[model samples]
Target: MSFLACRVFEKTESEKTESEKTSPKVQKTTIYHQLVQMETDELTAGDVLIRVDYSSINYKDALAASGRGKIMKQFPLNAGIDLAGVIVESDNDAYQAGDKVLVNGCGIGEQYDGGLAQYARVKSDWVIKIPEAYDTRQAMIIGTAGFTAALAIHRMQVNDQKPEMGPIVVTGASGGVGSIAVNLLSKLGYEVIALTSRKSMHDYLFELGANKVVSEDKLGMSDKPLGKALFGGAIDNIGGKTLSNIIAHTQLWGNVASIGLAQSPNLEAKVFPFILRGVSLLGISSTNCPMPLRTKLWHQFGKELPLPDFEAIVSKEIALEDVSPYFDELIDKKHHGRLIVNCQ
Candidate 1:
């Protein structure tokens, strides 16, 4: 080798030694705030660094992943809302290297580095040790969508809703949250009526345990503000006119949990249902849910909500690099079910 080349090699080795002696920080890069590249030293500082094994894309993830919605507060950010993995390093007393953990929402994939990459450095507070009955993949299969579904159900049940009270309607029934809600509600003995835009999903929704399947157009409002009472309660995933129609049709003293806005964000509804029939509109925000409740819900998911085949909800899986192509399909509401990401 030339003398200058040999000297450069020696200098590079010396620099590596120096870097090792002093822990170099993580340095992640972002392209258009959707695609993320994370190097060992690029991760943000935190009590623990996780080697993420899996993540899944939700509708919010589609928005951030496409750079179409202003959901991301910062640019050049990691953009997955859910992840499960093993801890590689820890500064907190509760966690150690190799401890399995999961993270969802809590401003991740938006205000902070998220789970799309193979590694993530996150606050100890944000970590939830994987429930005993669930592995990393199982946890990812449940993901944020399932977690939110469980939370919504728990809230309604706590408010005294019962299966015998009446049939429960789930809007956007083919999507992740709605599908899981249908399964869960049915498993718990509540009659489940699924609402979807596609008649094609009727059989699949039935297999997932939906007692009845109805089209969105069938739920359309009439000239009169209030329609004949149809459902006992509902899990309304489409927040706009569909929700309005659902509100108009709910039985007296029924409850509706508003979660997604696949159709639109506007809620064009009259107060007749709320005031006349004593219907309740329960707003569910799963992102900032308290840690205690989050842990409890995850435990319940592993126990009471276990699907016979978890992969049934996972309609597709893609490599980390291939995520962008699916964004258009998701944003246009062409995709059904959960899309898992394999970060390894």
Candidate 2:
């Protein structure tokens, strides 16, 4: 993925090295990814240019798309990690015009020009031919969260976690990653427990196949450093104290997959869980995950990760023009599940 070029490239060699050592470069530009007129010169050099049909608002997207966090490691940056659309033009032999494809991660949102706009020119390697089982709009509904969820589950299975072991807990249950994890774990026959701070989502979580829905505060007990064993395994979205607490309470030989940090970055935990119980804390970084693994996981998402009604997770849909207002809502934890953006 290529970032929109905004710098003049005039620094001395020493200054350039120092800058590279210190921080990634950023530049200011008026290139709006939201409901703005497209200019001919805006397309990046690539083998494929897609006219996006759908893109979803992940927590990171809200941070980058709405200019909340400095997630634009490079600027004049386009900010979206997940996109599904049709190929309007292609120069690569592997793809032709009119083919449907979807792309998530691989720096599309963070540094490269991304899917939030009506047009995206990306390398052929970054595109995945759309799975025959789904369409563009449906793919965006699953998007990056679903893809990452699949990867986490795959890792757990590879580590020998099976449904017969015991219950699996998913934190931030109402959000994209946690919700998909809940449904996937449930479908795979693990007794599923959803941890959410929003009391209003109790019923909704159950609808997604969570056998029990518990308050996040229940996991936030007084810091005893270790607690009674509770979950057999877990997929954690909120890190910090909640994750530390989960680590303390995980069953013997249980694994905890750390996928996000919506709460706090710091993790405070005693080493007893790993030493005594052999608990595994697997760190999941989906962005730079190798291509072969990414392809396998996405294929799984298309074939086996289908929920009973994925549309249920789609709480709201917004036009490209209206996405900015939702950023504050996301930061305040006022919404649930996935928010798809129809870019038309």
Candidate 3:
């Protein structure tokens, strides 16, 4: 069946019989096989059915949709890694029908059916209540990318990184995680230097609160184990040589949060930066982050961090049906900023 053939169904209280009122409601979801369609009775036990209002395309989502990376371990799985919506049916005491919630990573697109559809039945443990400050759209705008940035910042803060120390550099600053990191770190009073290969996005990055926008070429790789001490702290999204460069130039006792492997994953680095300069290389993993910490970071995004102009970061807003065409752009690295999927 065609994906567009999927239909949504909701039941009113009056429509339910006495026994059915307490029983979990069946939900029709846009499901994926070789094709897509609205399907019912797909939910397993202990799963909460969410009426997805919005979802966002991350690098992983793009990889999964295009079948480029080994992102989806299972075929015929729902695509899209991040979603925000309202709960329609719940088995968990922490949530109820009509509660706004969001789910990010936790192997959604990889290990289980994900959020590219009109509805999702996810494990209750993976569902986090959307903060009051954000609606479904805003939550998805932050999605996995913004959440990963916040997690990196939280780690840097724990390591005692302060604005007064020096500038915090964000490598791959035009991308989602890097963009959000630039905005968040700037808002927190750190001077942010955004590094991007796309020189065309310099003005855009500056508007997102980057104090300085530098070309990725400026971060020249060197054979020396220690380079000039430039950044006080860093949020590195591109790995390989870029990561090695960031490590070499970090100030004494500075922390560098390694969040992505957009570039090559291999790291050939000397131990001099670590043992001599006391630079700390922090590895950030958003996928399997503990629930308590995840909730806390989302709470911080809602209340503490100044919300960046999401419209500026949103490169495209397409419906679920139009998602396929954009995946190639994302995989090719031709798209900048975020791509939001309007599931509603």
Number of the top candidate by TM-score? 3
Candidate that beats the other on lDDT, 1 or 3, i.e. the better one: 3
Estimate TM-scores for all models: 0.87, 0.88, 0.88
User: Which segments of model 1 are wrong by more than 4 Å?
Assistant: 1-37, 220-223, 304-309
Candidate 3: where are CA atoms >4 Å away? 1-35, 43-46
Clashes of each: 7, 0, 0
lDDT of 3 at 336: 83
Model 1's alpha-carbon lDDT is: 0.79
The collision pairs in model 1 are 25-41, 26-41, 26-42, 26-43, 27-41, 27-42, 28-42
Query: Candidate 3 residues 280-303, lDDT tens each?
Result: 999999999999999998987757
lDDT per residue for candidate 1 within 163-201, as digits (tens), equals: 876899999888889888888888889999998878888
Ranking by lDDT: 3, 2, 1
Model 3, position 110: C-alpha lDDT score? 73
Error of 3 at 33 (Å): 8.4
Tell me how candidate 2 scores on lDDT. Answer: 0.80
Question: In candidate 3, how many Å is residue 324 off?
Answer: 0.6
Against the unseen true structure, what C-alpha lDDT does each candidate score?
A: 0.79, 0.80, 0.81
